[model samples]
Target chain A: MSVGYVSVQWNRHKRIYDACVAGGIVLYLGVFFAAGKALYTGRNAISGEILAMRALATCAFLMLNVILCIGPLARLDRRFLPLLYNRRHLGVATFLVALAHAAIAIGFYHGFGNVNPFVALLTSNTNFTSLSAFPYQTLGLFALLILFLMAATSHDFWLKNLGAPAWKRLHMLVYIAYGLLVMHVALGILQTQRSPWLASLVGVGVVIVATLHLIAGQRERRHDERGSQLSPRAGEEWVDVGAVDDIADQRGSTVTVGAGERIALFRYNGCVSATTNVCAHQGGPLGEGKIIDGCITCPWHGWQYRPADGRSPPPFAEKIHTYRVRVVGRRIQVDPTPLPPGTAVEPARVEEVQSA
Target chain B: MPGLILLGASIYATVGTLFGAGFVLRGVERVDPAALGAPWTFRILILPGVIALWPLMAWRWWCAPRTRGAA
Candidate 1:
């Protein structure tokens, strides 16, 4: 029912969202052309050094758009599926532009009355003759070829014909293309410009991407470690820990539920609370994340969940499945049966004892 | 002036085609060339547009319809 409601809301504004995206593209194109014209005025734009730079910029822009579409599409609901449904049109358009960029680059930069455009492209700059000439142009050529393959197979028809796994494996070459592009830009343009600001921008962008991936990777490793520690034991099944007092207030302790699911339990005042240790967003360990005013916040995207009920706060009502926990004498026992939304479960309480 | 105009035309066509194709692929219609309005508008729009397209393409692929009969 909730998913359906969310879907309906998304559908209501679908056209507006689509139109906004379309408008943004038109505006960007207008600027690109105007800039190109302003830069190269009067010369053969199709076959010039300045045009080559423009082409590279175009390829880079298209690639960036492709990257942006991944996150929102992954999370879109049934009503939002239309955004994903027509995504191929966008992919095809990007490819065509990239092709234009590559074509003009080859024709203008390497052709220009030179003998055999392909040969000229390959052998025009042989400054680095050692180590098989390194063939810098070939890197771009292969990248372009890979981009062509990806664009050609962007439609569902090719996806069905080629099979998903094979198609996906082939499409994975985008990363390779990305690396090649970086090398192409670094060697081709950056070396010539030697501008500190440009270098800093490139360096900063790479660093941010690397950092996000590294954090995501660390979260996955922690989940694996927790899983291994909680494998099913004979007859005993659930692991028994000595009193709720063992858990420090405000800090969460990792507990292994049956079937190797790792959960973090936090004790506040006299109330006990629990939630999945792994965050839904990028698997950030909830166990490691700090508690803020009785809510556990995922460090990755700042998604917060009430530890007592495992329900996300208002404006974000997503909920993670919760486990049943009870205190039997000195032993703390947790039930593996998962609770659904709106089901009320009483939190276990520990009696306070004064030390002499 | 004619020489400059010719050079400008060529650059415009080349850059326009590249960016135009990019805009279409990202489903970005109704683009406002004057959004930033002259001066730095070219760098502002084109640079971000170029940087943003790759992730958009990847999003498209991931969100594309799954092949039937495949898990």
Candidate 2:
């Protein structure tokens, strides 16, 4: 929320969040290495280098799973919202750990060969057609490249410059990267080791991620469908959303207008105002956010916009479309037509409707 | 085969480094007023991104309207 950019607008929450991430990474790696040594002894012993590589690889995979889960989990329940706040840090950390694993594996396997390690990584495994001996390293490499691009552009500077839509489209490549990494593990270790436990772990992770996303998607679809039912039909001027009391003070209730145009109706200072449900920063659900200090704050990153005009306060040049709202006999009705972004429409006073 | 790729990457990175140094020092403020008066840490933190994206930065630097206080 700064007028100007610093490296990061680091605060107490971010500091604590990063500390927890660091501690968890260290603990996971330590336990992994220790368990490997204790479990696999003498005849089936693994070297320290291999153990380190495996530890980092597993840690990165688990971190990625958690990262993917955080969004759907947050949508399902607000308690997980705290996890969503510092997710990019976790993502960057995942890349670093994965890079470490790649470095170790490449060096150990191909560093001593006649050609470059990367070249050996690409050329040594030319058996792409064979399912049993496919070039899984290439999948991992491409995934790493995607991760690197994401980590590189994770800053607000890039977000602001690229515009939210383009930035979002670019970051959505994470799904592809996730898919690649999944295949990388399936084809790499699962093929060679034939470890049931590892296979089960990957299977469970994929299931959990898929299930959570499906559940969240269903919930959102239902919300939109409900809004659609309440929307104004042909020739109808205003659509009745619900009673003003349905929205809590300083809180919002989302309604879908004509053809899936989602609007967030906010109640504040005895008046009701409406704005587009989409946040300008990250397309976060603005309806789920509350009015903080006379401004509607985005739940995702706390970017605020004045509910009256849908404008972010001075020095923050973001805006969302405003909708015309009216209260008639305690019932809130919003015009299906949207005004331009930052257009000021008079709010309908709840007290006026109550008195009438 | 890998040596050629590595050499090309090295060259690109070298050019990026030089361009990034100048962009961070003199050109950043012109493109983004927010970067003006930003600390050394901020500049250093953005160095890698700037290096990786030097061409884009250069394009923005060349085209974006000059902000106040930028020399």
Candidate 3:
């Protein structure tokens, strides 16, 4: 197997992605229209209709948060990566529905009459005098503002313009929005002490979901750190394998050569290559994914990298740290020094193995 | 409950129209509100405004394909 023999293509599924976004928009608009009608009618009390409307709004927000989280989490698990790749539309749709929720809350409950809608929203039901006069509406307003920013910049154009680091930092505001929303519901709706059971249920649901994410994220971070430490140090000589056939195709076989780092060997064509098993995208075990047409596609997000160079294809354009390799006798050898991206190396030539 | 249901239905309808327009802009099939028994004024007039620029948006997306070597 020769390293130069393999080439990978990186592309997205635009059709399905577009369809998912379109579907989400349809659902969002439907909810927005429903909320609009309620606002126009000037009904403020938490009737069944209003409650139902609020519930729908809550569901939409929850879904949007999930979409937001999926992008990062998918790096850890390819199965989950699809959720991230197509999550923008979901976020935008959620924002639109949330806007409707806010509009109804403001228009029907705090109609612009004697007091400004903003003032009324913050001032309504001051029975809980002990709490800060910092109206619950302020929290909701802030959360809505964050959501607005997130939705506005959900497009790739904004991402490209802002740059990934800046865009990612801006998007992190979702956590702040999430916190504000929790407080908004607690201080405003929950404090009214009406529908305690329903409020408690919502509270519990949010806590459980948040806790699950926190725990999973922490565990993944720890695993990534451990994998990073295990990576080969620079300038170490690789051990040799007898032949390329010694490595499995599209699968990783753990191998340790004398006085060198342990590496995952992959055979594409007749050539043998090595990389740390942990995926750079999110610490997924690279050894688990199959070789497809000369590239190793991450099982999580379909992020494809050439086995020879560990360079992700276009559109993603990320290169993982790669080790050097050599073949001596029937065994394979590797160098611990990680070659920078676009560096050229000698190709491996081995006889192709017959399928079992 | 019925009152609430009616309110919910109405709100859903307005939101649906806006959402539908967004989808239409994305190039999905346009939803016919009349089929859902909505008022013609809402289905035809208000809804179209929400989606007035959608056709152009759809055209843009269709024109610039993101995936390489796509038909």
Provide C-alpha RMSD values for all models, in order.
14.2, 2.4, 12.7
Predicted model with the maximum TM-score: 2
| Among all candidates shown, the one with the greatest DockQ | 2
- Give the per-residue lDDT digits (tens) of candidate 2, residues B1-71: 55687788789899999999998888877888877798887788777778888888899889988655445
For all predicted structures, in order, the TM-scores are: 0.46, 0.93, 0.58
Candidate 2 overall lDDT versus native: 0.88
Residues A81-103 of candidate 3 have per-residue lDDT tens digits of 56655555567667777787788
lDDT of 1 by residue, A152-261 (tens): 55533333334557666876776687677666555554445545865565566556555555665676566556655544357654555346778777666666543456
> Which is the winner by DockQ between candidate 2 and candidate 3?
2
lDDT order, best first, reads 2, 3, 1
Model 2 alpha-carbon miss at residue A29, Å: 0.5
Candidate with better TM-score, 1 vs 3: 3
Q: Given candidate 1, what's the lDDT at residue A150?
A: 71
Go through the candidates in order and give each one's C-alpha lDDT: 0.55, 0.88, 0.58
Model 3 alpha-carbon drift over 4 Å, by segment: A1-53, A68-78, A114-116, A119-129, A132-134, A225-248, A251-267, A272-290, A298-305, A310-322, A326-336, A347-356, B1-71
- Indicate the residue-level lDDT of A131 in model 2: 89
Arrange candidates, best TM-score first. 2, 3, 1
Docking class of 3: incorrect
What ranges in model 1 sit over 4 Å off?
A1-22, A32-62, A65-93, A127-135, A158-163, A235-356, B1-71
